[model samples]
Target: MDAKQYANLIDKELQEMPLYVFYYTQQPNLSVTTIYQYLTEYRRFFNWLRETPKDIENPNAGSISDAKSNKEIKLETLKHLQASQVQMFLKELSIKQNKQSTRDSKKTINRTINALRSLFHYLTVTADLNDGEPYFYRNVMLKIPLIKGVKESISYRNAKFSPMLYTGEKKRKWIDFIENEYEHTISTRRRSSFLFNKERDLAIISLLLGSGIRVSELTRLNLKDVNLRDRSIIVLRKGDKKDAPLIADWAMPYLENYLKIRKQRYQPDKSEQALFLTKYAGKAKRIATNTVECFVSKYSTAFPDGNRTTPHKLRHSLGTELYDKSKDVMVVATQLGHTGISATDQYIQQTEVEKQRIQLDKTK
Candidate 1:
């Protein structure tokens, strides 16, 4: 979703303080998606506090009022939050079931911690309240630590996804399988829709593998962002950085094919600036992130030696391939629009782990 969509969602959720609005909108660095996520995390923590009121105390030795709604929980509640209560919230998050009914991962828990930390940091240091003073002098979040085992989680993900990634020969064959072979594999009922969307799907998957752009970047892409002559496309990268990443020569043909027939096939309104469009309920709208994920999964599951995968794995395929060829972490980082080499460093570690795994398999 775009900024407006995310803002609308934020409006529907609890906006307990003007500080919440300022935190999300006034900050130039936070992406719309990040704002939405942080708001939800704030709500989660607030709800947890309401349910576990014993965790809360009035700083002035006064009784804490029962918060009938999330909005009813005033700023003073956050000011007096203790370290132990925050720790308990993190523990609950670890075992919390999402809409998928699966327990939250450590990453999710850490993100929640990070979100709360941002909020507290702003209240204590950033916000200018009455008399030019911040909300509170004590930041409880400073005492909380993020969950560890990040490297282990990265290794686990690398091991599981490395084999499924499309790189080298697999990259070319995956696209080939989609064009010539995919239709034959699906049922007659599904084939019609598949054929109708073949070009757009191919372009989407090809772009993902060809350039290491995030799924969010691709979904939020606009028609004017593509510079075909320069062999690059401009994107609003994470942290809202405007970047133009080069696309692979191999993926150009698929993109070109899609461009030639996009308007005719999708019949999008002239005012529609979205680079990719899907026809739904007789209206052409920008292709959504979930829609891209679904088709990517469908195609990968049908491909021989392919597992059900996400657009991110396709990004990994590109990143790993770039690192292998250039043997330079900086180049991969630039292409992937990573602010630091740490994330790109995982590509190197993942490849090393993959190699070690193969050697072990050979020994076995």
Candidate 2:
């Protein structure tokens, strides 16, 4: 979804949460996606507080499930929570298995901790009560530590991702497969839908691999954002910062092919300005980020050894490919609009890591 859609969802969440949460989520420069994530974490933590048994010593704290809603729970129950209880909640999260039946990763747990920390910080240091004082000086999240091995996790992630990249000749081959061969693999009933979206799908994946824009950035593009003569597209980066990234010459034909038919194929309304269009109820709408992810996953999984990768993986492919050509981290960082070279550094490391993995396999 776009930022506007997420903002609408955030407004609904605020209705169920405390007034303090509204202030917290409204702070300037916090992306709508970030605000939505914080609200999700808050809901999960609140549900845990409500379902857990009442404490023996805290007899008056029977407000657990009796409270009508999260707002009441936040006001009456949150203020009385002990640091031990917060720690126990983290412990439960550590062992909890998701719908996929896999334990939460340290990174996932750390995100929860960060969200809770933001809430507590807002309550303690930011929000002012009716009496012109902070909620309660005690912030339980301060006592909860984020999981360690974050640096190790980064390297581990790069190693796992290195083999999945569509670098070198593989990038062209992947795009060709989608354009020419992908229809044969699906059922006849599904082929019509597949053919209907063929050019649009190929264009989306090509742009991602060619320019390294985030999926969110891709979904936000309007018709005017594309500069055919310049071979660049303007994108809103993280924090709503705008930058124009050059598109690879090889990917331009797919983009042209899609644009030539976009109006006729989608029958977009005159007011519709989205660069990519999706038809809904016979009306054209800007494509959603989730829809982009779903199609990227589907197409990539069909390609040989594609491993069901994400758009972000395609982003890494572009980063590494640029690094290989320019042999400059600074160029990759600028192309990817990374604020620092730190993240761009990983694209350089991926080659060495892949070599070491190959050596280990040779030894085996």
Clashes of each: 0, 0
| Best model per lDDT | 2
Give lDDT: candidate 2, residue 142.
Answer: 82
Off by over 4 Å in 1: 2-4, 15-25, 55-65, 95-102, 153-157, 350-364
Summarize candidate 2's per-residue lDDT along 178-237 as a digit string, tens digits.
Answer: 888889899999999889888998999999999999999999999999999999999999
Global Cα lDDT for candidate 2: 0.85
TM-score of each: 0.88, 0.89
Candidate with maximal TM-score: 2
Give the distance in Å from residue 41's predicted Cα in candidate 1 to where it truly belongs.
Answer: 1.8
Error of 2 at 297 (Å): 1.3
**Residue 154 of model 1, lDDT score:** 71
lDDT of 1 by residue, 49-121 (tens): 6677562454444323358767677777778877887887788777778788988898888898899888888
**Which whole-number lDDT from 0 to 100 does residue 237 have in model 1?**
80
